[model samples]
Target: MSRIEPPSTDPVNSKPARAATGDGLDPGGRRRARRYDPDRKTRILDAALDVLAEHGAAGTTHRRIAASAGVPLGSITYHFATLIDLRAQAFARYVEQQSAVFEELLEVVRTREEFVEILVDLVHGGPARYRSAVLGFELHLAALRSPDLRVLTQAWTRDSRAALARFTGPDVAARLDALLKGMIMNVLLATDPEPREATRAAIVQTLGPADGSRP
Candidate 1:
């Protein structure tokens, strides 16, 4: 839109001079300026998580992520060096987000009943927890091949256990983390998930006696 003035309307001496448009844009407006999307990287990361949850790391590609995020393929390369890097970062973000959700879900626990119910909800949290659970498993599978991803999973495990330790003691929290992983993976594969009562029993057993000692 930055226009250049003509040479005084172009008289005999000027001989119909054209406008001086040296601002890297044509006067005819054929081309557009580069878009300013400050949140482009964030959108790409979210789209990466979506792709990972749906397709696992094996199916994730720059082209797929580009299409999902509504960005150019080159944009994915510009932001992320490789699909592996993207997957690891995406899982990191998921862990960060799920960590907050875990805290919020536990924030309302006032009794053993409430804590157990919350753990049950976590196992079968419906759509709210489904995507996160998928991403968690995908991260674990990916970590087996990528040491960087393994580091992320290790830290995620530590933090998750720390959060759970607030309710159960550290020993129980550690065991609970393993139990939740197995139970969640099982639930994901089960055509008909076990009833909430069964999940509650498992959680209570994980909690051991009321003294917070390991069962």
Candidate 2:
């Protein structure tokens, strides 16, 4: 055996590489080695959505998501264990992100027509717009199959219904919620080629005109 070199004279050796503890966070530092970054996770989720939109469900992978997120490939596993986990989280995030738009639209409208106009705009053309309905379908499909996802979906439905009811009153809120969700589902399915305006009109008809009075 060659004479044992007195430990290599590298800076890493001289300084001794610090290992992250049980928390995966450096003891003296604020950042964690294996912990998820909220910003990074959001970016990764968005990138994952883009990848899914471009290549469908099966085309997305850790490397692709990492590339999209502009993070190292190793960080993917650090944040998510399986593709399903990643997909589920991404879908959940998408739903949560979209809800803000719906809430804002509902908030501004004083009447049912105004509400429907906003609804139509949101469905037909809003920020985070998709070229095709596949991504929406994919998320809905995943939620349909996963109880965890369904819980989140149901919460969204309940919250949305409550918001609409706040403006439209309990008497019509349920019906309005059903119409709005149904319209979105129909659009996602692509079975109804009718303009979103038609769906909005249908919802307005269901509302039978806004009372324009706070309950």
Q: How does each model score on lDDT?
A: 0.75, 0.64
Candidate 1: RMSD to truth? 15.2
Instruction: Give per-model TM-scores.
Output: 0.81, 0.69
lDDT of 1 by residue, 1-215 (tens): 11111112112322322222443245886644757999999899999988888888889877778789998666677676556556666777777777777878788878777888888888877886888888898888877866556666776787889888888878989999998898898899999988878888998898877864321
Error of 2 at 119 (Å): 1.8
Model 1 clash number: 0
Tens-digit lDDT track of model 2 for 1-215: 01111111223323332222333345776656554467886787788888887776768877788788888765666666566667767766656655665677666777555766776765575435544346766655666655455655665666677777777777688887777666666665576556965877787787775454752
Off by over 4 Å in 2: 1-38, 131-134, 188-192, 212-215
> Which numbered prediction scores highest in TM-score against the true structure?
1
lDDT of 1 at 145: 68
* Candidate maximizing lDDT: 1
- Stretch of 10 with least lDDT, candidate 2: 1-10
TM-score (C-alpha) between model 1 and the true structure? 0.81
